[model samples]
Target: MKIFKITGEFFLAVLKRTAFSFLDLMKIIVPVYTMMTILSYTPVIKFLADWLKPAMKIFGLPGESALALILGNFINLYAAIGVMPLLHLTPWQTTTIALMLLTSHSQLLETSVFFKLKTRAIFLLILRLSVAIMVGLLLALR
Candidate 1:
């Protein structure tokens, strides 16, 4: 009776919330994925790879690995993973990228979250990116 009505309302609320959250995630993921796909077809990715090759060499990764790092940092780890196979990275390179992403991925999303918490987004971004690069450099030395 009353219990059933309350349960139904609760379930409906949960469903609505879930749907909205999914939409929010899709808003971020789909556009980035499409852009990355288009970039793959263009020479832009190649140019970026060449431009970043020297920096990437420090991490023992191919120049193309820059795409993964850029996607991971600006978009999200899932976006980076989606772009990864296209680059045909080695196992070591994959591991290095994974570690870097672990330290600093989803910059826009996480920065917004941090901002809502009254924290300095730029500081957090710099800290995470610096730590990620340092870890990559250390791993490359091994």
Candidate 2:
């Protein structure tokens, strides 16, 4: 079918792109990314996560989610996507958590990917989190 062909082509394109993109990313970002990774592993991440635990709990997620949020912020969504399977979130929980993660997902990296309206990304991301929190809190109340 046409749909199948299109899907197949899309996946092939993605594979090619991912392979090329990896090299490009490694060339440009690997050094900085490595340094950041080292910093992340050196207790700073845990310290910040601990500090933010209370605020994170308000959204029905625990501290681990905070780590995921931070990971998603600096690194990328790949890590968070891996963590999602382990969490085994329910449908409502998924929506709430997805909203929360998507709110500020990958601000450091992808923000520049937006050529125009760069500042709006942060504002929109915050708005997303707020709306997600309000909706999630209301649902939890009921």
Candidate 3:
């Protein structure tokens, strides 16, 4: 029947589209996953995490979260995105932490890319953390 033929074609088309979408997702995800794995083992991550502890303490985030925050701040937002699977943060905690990071993510890189005005990167970093911690504290209180 023509109706049956049309339905079969539609089903096959949907299946083909789904498979291609999954393949595209894998292509994008694989490199980021690999990079995150390599970055996890790097001493730089450890050092930055340690460097951020006292400040991160104000928001009650673990040092490992600080590593993600710092990477997100200085590198690219994808840095934080890539690290999330490796982190042990709960969904709520992850959202809170990620929001904080995104509030000032990759300022230096982004500023340079946009050719914006120059300012002390450290000053901005501290201000961003202060705001993030305040928001985090408010969320915790709620």
Candidate 4:
């Protein structure tokens, strides 16, 4: 009887934590997805797609991918992921973006930390971006 009660309590706690986590994720993903959907109906997405196409192609990604990269670098991976489903990217493209973003995500926050350390923040920023581009290119070629 005691074991059953403990097990039930544990499961209740797990359920509560899961629900909270889901809500937190939805808070970020929902807004970004909504905004991306709205932009799709306007020329803004098209304009950005066209503007970024050439540069993005070098990494084997669509122009729409630039939004994800920007959001991932400046905001967080959740924001980038929120834009991904709308992009209809290929598996390879998804993999490449995941790798690139994982390599150099959260630049603004991390750059400030680097500055506080009295390091050459600009150099580190350039290095991370360069590495991200290189990783994207390498995955794209494969």
* The best candidate in terms of lDDT: 4
The models' CA-based lDDT, in order, is: 0.87, 0.63, 0.71, 0.93
Off by over 4 Å in 4: 1-6, 113-124
lDDT of 2 by residue, 21-134 (tens): 777655535554555467556887567668887886676665546655656566665556545544446676666666666655676666666526556766665665567567
Q: Rank the candidates by TM-score, best first.
A: 4, 1, 3, 2
Candidate 1 segments exceeding 4 Å error: 1-42
Q: Taking the tens digit of each residue's C-alpha lDDT, what string does model 3 give over 1-142? A: 8999999999999999999977765664566668767877888667866887777666666666876776677766666776777767778778778778767777777656444555665666667767876787765554
Judged by whole-model lDDT over C-alpha atoms, candidate 1 comes out at 0.87
List where candidate 2 sits over 4 angstroms from the true fold.
Answer: 1-52, 115-142
Winner on lDDT (2 vs 4)? 4
Work out the TM-score per prediction: 0.71, 0.50, 0.56, 0.84
Structure candidate 3, residue pairs in collision: none
TM-score of 4: 0.84
For candidate 2, give the lDDT of residue 117.
Answer: 56
Compare candidates 1 and 3 on lDDT and give the better one: 1
RMSD of each: 4.1, 6.3, 6.5, 2.5
Query: Model 2 Cα displacement at 82 (Å)?
Result: 1.3
Candidate 1 matches the true fold with a TM-score of: 0.71
User: What shift in Å separates residue 127 of candidate 2 from its native position after superposition?
Assistant: 5.1
Candidate 2: the clashing residue pairs are: none
